[model samples]
Target: MITPIYRVQCDGPGKEWLSLPEGHVTGADVTADNLIAAPTAKRACNWPGEKEAKRAAVGAGWRHAPDSDFKTWFCPACQSAGTRP
Candidate 1:
């Protein structure tokens, strides 16, 4: 079976500055690892093709940080205010 490998673009802060929301709860002991482990799916794209996915994400005002992992993406509002997750 050819399981399609769709690229998941997370609508959250880039890994470099990734962190949980101010009041987010994980039901576990708060730790550095977990604090930055959560990712929000507020806006996501599951396009099978990398180029197409990136095109769609960018079209929606998502910016890909060059220094971050490919999966990390910031929403339009965040990008405008230069905010981080």
Candidate 2:
């Protein structure tokens, strides 16, 4: 069975942090179309489970924004730069 992959999005301007690839499509092969369609952003904490992902994210200077409707994770650069909303 395929499990969900969790990735923490970084609200930073750093190219390194903003260029991380998002999770792969489940139950699908990596094709050219998919590769081109895959969305990428400033993200980290690529893990299989949410809890571990969040833990690692936090450990890596990511913070969970409680006010956002969706789960938003800000990277260290964003935090340091005051770019987080």
Candidate 3:
């Protein structure tokens, strides 16, 4: 099993607690956008992940946003289009 990442913090004199842990996603948990469109398109896209996403992001005219680890791995197009990752 994967170890969860988290940190503890003191809110006030009342008590202290831990913050919500942001879970990590393995490659298996990731899905390609092409796969999402496959059912409708009736074909497999076989689109790559990080590399392709970064490329698409650059192509979309962004300097450096897709590379941010602060958020999930959203598609470059989605990020450019202002959608949630």
Candidate 4:
């Protein structure tokens, strides 16, 4: 199955950056090489303390149709908007 990946920061006692896919943990003492597959619902907490994350998930590209709560679409132009600025 395809899953969203996350870049994690490890600080405090140690420092490192890790790539934690749906099944990985990126945190202290764990380098990229130390990654392991986490449980299926690993990303449950990814949005808890993050504002940008919640924004990206809900505000990125979505629409409300007649029968749907909201539909989502990707804006390629928006991705490039940062370079122009």
Winning candidate number (lDDT): 2
Q: Tell me, what's the RMSD of every candidate?
A: 10.8, 9.1, 15.1, 14.1
Better of 1 and 3 by TM-score: 1
Error at 28, model 3, angstroms: 26
Q: Which candidate comes out best when scored by TM-score? A: 2
Candidate 4 lDDT over 1-85, as tens digits, reads 7555432232212222222445444564423243322333343234333343334433433112234332322222322333111
| Residue lDDT tens for model 2, 1-85 | 9778775556456523312335654554433222211135433324678776566666555665679644776766667777777
lDDT of 2: 0.52
lDDT head-to-head 1 vs 2, winner: 2
List the pairs of residues colliding in candidate 3: none
lDDT of 1 by residue, 9-67 (tens): 44544432233345555454433333232244432223567776566556555677776
Model 1 misses residue 27 by how many Å? 39
Please give the CA lDDT of all the candidate structures.
Answer: 0.49, 0.52, 0.31, 0.31
Return the lDDT, model 3, position 52. 55
TM-score of 3: 0.22
lDDT for model 4 comes to: 0.31
Worst 10 residues of 1 by lDDT: 36-45
Which candidate model has the greater TM-score, 1 or 2?
2
Angstrom error of the Cα, residue 63, model 4: value is: 7.2
For model 2, the stretches where C-alpha displacement exceeds 4 angstroms are: 13-45
